[model samples]
Target: MIRAVLFDLDDTLLRLNLTAFIARYVAGASRLLASVARTTPVALGVPYVRAFLAMDAQDREDSLTNEQLFNKTMLEACGIPLDDPVIADLMTYYEERIVPGFSSGVVAARPVPGAREAIEAVHDAGLICALATNPTFSLACDRARMGWAGVDEKDFALVSTYSNSTRCKPSTRYYQEFANQLGVRLEECLMVGNDAVRDIVRDGCGLRTAYVGHGRPRGAVWRGPMERLARELPDLVARLDEQDA
Candidate 1:
């Protein structure tokens, strides 16, 4: 009955060159970490990339939260001891200070034109609203980007982050866990995102998708930009409810 609407953050709610941003972010982080450790950024950069890839692999049976996996892998790859204080310091500094500072120099990171209004439409329909961005970053990192997207953290019922989520997106398990957290069935949620393959569920996952990307994908029931979504979402939600009834 469309009890919840899950929104993807990057490229969907926030318009930015994601690849470029990742590169810049990794470079900045490497430099910052190297300065503290008295090592070369190049040394830190290699391990950071490896750790990120390990997190993003989306293993269905893994029990660890993405944050735990990231930390474990990052430290192991860097050959640092498990009890090192640097990990804690790095996490704190990166989340609290470094990420927020990126907003100024990164001109490409801007809120999608109608993203906020689209969120409001979900609220107006009385549906649970969730930020279902890939759970590869901390809540602080997600919140910082959400601020750049002009959305308030207070508005969402669920905000997926590395510490909270066990699986990455494009895996049905991620959506399954999200719905379970919201106390709803998968069929009751509609995923709204720009990536066709990553956001859309297949193989009888039961969730429907609304693609907001450039071209229509096979599984998406609706296709349009965020502006159109803002205008039409209530009606669409109503339609889904009626169909369910």
Candidate 2:
């Protein structure tokens, strides 16, 4: 019997043009850091950004954390020797300025039409709701994204952020941890998100899974509308209700 629903944030509950957000943030951060760094904005900034992204891509593929890969990639990309004072300053700048500035763009998130209604229906049924976003960001960052997606922090029984989780999505360990936190059996949870590879695959961990379908990346199977999502939950609940009976 399903007792919990977990939702992925970006491109799932919230629609985002990742390329646009990244470009705008990089440009803004580069300019902001230029005067202080005493270098051409792109010269210092773009390489660091590229390095960061590279590290992220590598981390996703290798199951490493962002911090584990960031500094080494940055040092290698900049060729500035690992212990350079400039590298230290750049890291400081990124953490202090760039991350927060980029996060500000998330405030522009608009809910996928009907997503709020679907979530409301699930909540009304007395099932637990969770925001199971990849735990690579702070709670403040997750809250900002949730605000953009039209989900309040209050809506979730559990909100998984990097500060609060030791693992990330696509890892069954993370899903299990979330289930444990919510006091729900893995088989009694539904993992809902846009990514088939990350979200739907959580079914392997014993959770029922729903692919959000909209906003799928290239070559992904399309599911359908948010209203269909809303419509489908009752059937799932009915099945679980029968199992309980």
Candidate 3:
């Protein structure tokens, strides 16, 4: 019976052009870290990008926290040995500059039209709300983006982050952990996101799911834009409840 609704943040609640955000952030990050390195930002960009990719790859397998894995890989990519003082500086740049910069300055984000109303619809239906964002970034990063998207953090019962989650999106374990955290079965929760493959791990995770756009549900739970979701969710929730009963 639709006890919870987990919403994806990027491209769903907020419109963040991933390519654009990445370019801006990489530039900002290089400059931020270059103070410690006596080299060109472009050279730093190469390994910075590589390390981030490595972290994403590691996120799926190891139980290491995202910060732990990122620290190890980034230090290795930079040719800095563990326990080097420079590792501290890199981490400082990440925590103090990189992630926060995305929200206010490094990248521009826009709220998805009607997302707030859709969230409200979910609430009115007496379902719990959660942010099932990919666990690649810290909670602060997701919270900042959520603020721009007009989603109040206070409203969510669970918000996934790198420190809290072991797996990233597209992995069934990610959704499984999310539902486990909420203490609900997959069928009792509905996941809504823009990315078809990453958000709805239906065949893998067996969770009810929804997509946003012209894309049909296509073995998903629901499909429509935010405006339509705002209108459809309450009725849909009622129908699901009846079916479950």
Top candidate when judged by TM-score against the true structure: 1
lDDT, candidate 2, 128-203, per-residue tens: 9898987755566576667767888899989886545545667676778788999988878877787776675423
**lDDT (C-alpha, whole model) for all candidates:** 0.84, 0.67, 0.76
Q: Identify the runs in model 3 with alpha carbons over 4 angstroms from their true place.
A: 58-60, 80-108
Instruction: Assess every candidate by TM-score.
Output: 0.93, 0.69, 0.84
Flag regions of model 1 displaced more than 4 Å. Answer: 81-86, 104-107
The per-residue C-alpha lDDT of model 3 at residue 127 equals: 87
| lDDT digits (tens) for residues 1-245 of candidate 1 | 88899999999999877777777777877777677667888997778787788778955467888888877887787764323676566766776787766765554789998999999999888899999999988788888889889997888999999888888878888889888998999999999999988898787988998889998798898899999999999888888889889
Clashing pairs in 2: none
Candidate number that wins on lDDT, 1 or 3: 1
The alpha-carbon RMSD values of the candidates against the true structure, listed in the order shown, are: 1.9, 5.4, 3.1
Looking at candidate 2, the ten consecutive residues that score lowest on lDDT are: 214-223
- Model 3, 1-245: lDDT tens per residue? 77999999888888877677767767866776665666667777777676567656724567776656665776777754424677565755575555655655435688999899988888887889999988876676676678778887898999998777766777777788889999998888888898877877756445777788556757676778888988999887778779779
